[model samples]
Target: MTTILIKQVSWQQHQPELQALRQQVFVVEQKVPAELEWQADDEDAYHWLAYGPQQQVLGCARLLKTGTLGRMAIAKTARGQNIGLRLLQAAMDFAQQQLGLAEVHLSAQTHALGFYQKAGFVSEGAEYHEAGIPHIHMRKKLSPQPQLGISNGKFFVSQHKNTVLTMAQQCRRQLRILDYNLNPAVFDNQALVDAVSALARRHRNSSIKLLLIDSQAVIKRGHGLLKLQRKLSSSIAIKQLSDDTGVSDNLVLADDCGVIVQSLVNPETIWADFNNKPVAQSKIDHFEILWGQANANNDFRLLDL
Candidate 1:
């Protein structure tokens, strides 16, 4: 657990040291062909190097603008303490933050796929050989994020675990309705429906989430939630669950056994059933796959015409 610090390299200052380190690690130790080791594009890339307190290069990685992350190498002295994962994370962050890449791809040595998987990269296509080593192309998608607005003034907000509730008596939360590929009106007339409707009316223009999961085809029907979702109108995002993937939508449903809705003022506070669960990201990933393939080309505003 030795402390390691990473420094962003400035071409004029760190290039020589970086080149020397690469030559030692890639050309000599790893036997990466010389021609492939030094590309003309190195001068334009954002480079980072991890250094011990004495200023020795412990690890390094580079970010290329083409969304290709490559050339990560660590000193032989630092091989087993997980320095590589840190380098990879730094490279991935730079690729997304500085280069604005949507998807980051890496050509990982076959044996190292497990390492990449831990960092959120999935293998693509099939295995191939690069520079006399077995390799696989791996990719990780960066979530599309919006500029987060800062709240200048502190408002009196209450917390329910992570779920935020407004000051309203019966309607202080945003509820995401889960539709199991069915109509949205299945729960409209129940006590759950009346409570949610009253809350929505209280908020007026705030957005409440409704998530639909259609498992009837897979599970052969039993849940009442799935039935309500099928009847809901369009203009809503209803994602289907599959065994192969995880949920893709950050938009999640409520956790109550009955219908769930919360105040829009603290939408981020609502916790889904998967809250604090380790596999929650996998669930969101599953929803994203279905969402990506769903047709959304219609002009939403012109639907009335």
Candidate 2:
């Protein structure tokens, strides 16, 4: 892999290299019309350039304050070397930080869908031709809002609340956890190991199962927890949940307090207990209902292993 340095560029300083790359890729190679290519207010637009160790510009992109991101180009020599991703990352970061934009939208060429997808941009609708080339709108959610609460001390979004960045959980006490469709942050193996170890120390000789939900296990990073499960061994049984399924409402019944951790995208409607604690009884019941449906048959496999 080639080493690349990303830096914000003044429109004037980067204009020559940027226009050349754009003319090469979008105009000459992709047949984009010169009329539509470079016109309008580019002076106010923020531009970025990627450079090699020798300060040779390898890629460039511009983020106009229209909530629209466009004109990203990578030199032909830098193609397949991931310079485009670096440019997009820089562009998105600038748009979020300086512009405070909620979403960065782009009309991505159809063939480049995979590239954008890897960079976290989701395709929205049907493809249309622009300058005779097929294109589609793509958007990436830049500021990944946390649900609330940290796992041990490091920042981890609450997949349930969709807003709060909760403090990390390091206590050994049994927790009365709540459920919300949350996108919990990916945890390192050591953290998972610590969680499993803590659970073991708290619930010694008790039947404690590791309920792996669809969003957390398969969707987010399936293989991560699978590795943690192996390191944990027979201490906790791994249960898998289908995408449509949820936890059993009686998830609280098996233990003194339940630990509910899932992505907050599809939150369980309930938020607090009668006493206003974070634990929600009704949602816990729903979790139990879904929990019973999860296939108990053990199947934790890691691709790398």
Candidate 3:
């Protein structure tokens, strides 16, 4: 196996190398038309070049400003070395860690659908012809938006509300929230209510469980989440922790991968990381113990489904 190294290159500094690689793969080998192959966007797009021994270009891919990833090509000699996969990872890492793009879109050659799918991209719509080749639209959501909030920072009320809502929008399988009171300003918002509702319809096994220290106040406040739960009783469950439970931190877990942690002692102090499975799992494990001991607030039983 050959060692593969990937690096982002500038069109201005590495034009000869970039063009040579693309021309070799996309034009000569694939017979893509020379006129159609060269685009003005090359100069502005983010270019990633994979190198073999002695810094020879092995593969290349580009990400456009609009979050489109394309122009991916691997040398014939390098096809079996996983050079293409590493190059694609480089592009995606840059998009998520540096560019802060919420998601990426690509027109994948139909035959390569499985290749991209292996990297967590989902294919959408029917196959269409592009440059005389069958292609399909595909996209992968990067780590969810309103990204990680460090514990050192204090959030304004609006920031906290927006972050939870944005995180809720990305939930797929399940959403588990453990909070002090299920604050009306954050959990009762229409945006979160709608997101949870949509998630419930996404799968029959989808689950939403909320643990609150106080349910009487939430019910009296006419919370939208409580209302949603009553209407979707089979999909949503709300429980109240007894006073004996020592938990004081508020947590919002999305799909068991994303998390928003807030200090109940200091509501403004918060931390949100949308891609930390370990932290989410640990917090969820503790939450489950509490969830099991917590009583299903009978108040919800009074509302008609």
**Per-residue alpha-carbon lDDT of model 1 for 1-305, expressed as tens digits?**
36566666865688888888788898999798999888877888778888876878888888878988888888888888777776776676566555678999889988788988988899989888888989999999975422212112222111221122111122344344333333322343344544444555554453344444444442343333323333333312334443223432234332221112222333322232322222434443443456565443222223232
Model 3's alpha-carbon lDDT is 0.79
What's the TM-score of each model vs. the native? 0.48, 0.48, 0.49
lDDT per residue as tens, model 2, 130-182: 88889999988776422222221222221222111111233233322222221
Model 2 vs truth, CA RMSD? 14.9
Candidate 1 vs. true structure, TM-score:
0.48
State the local distance difference test value for candidate 2.
Answer: 0.56
lDDT by residue (tens digit), candidate 3, 1-305 = 34555677899998899899899988898789999999999988899888776888888999998889999998888897766776776677667656878899999999899999998899999999977889999999975334432222322221466678877887888899887778886788788899999988889999999888876677666778878888887999888887735787888888767788877665545667777777778988988999999987677654443
Single out the weakest 10-residue window by summed lDDT for candidate 2: 158-167
- For model 3, what is the error of residue 93's alpha carbon versus the real structure, in angstroms, after optimal superposition? 22
Residue 14 local lDDT, model 2: 72
Query: Which 10 consecutive positions of candidate 1 have the poorest summed lDDT?
Result: 148-157
Candidate 1 Cα RMSD (Å): 19.3
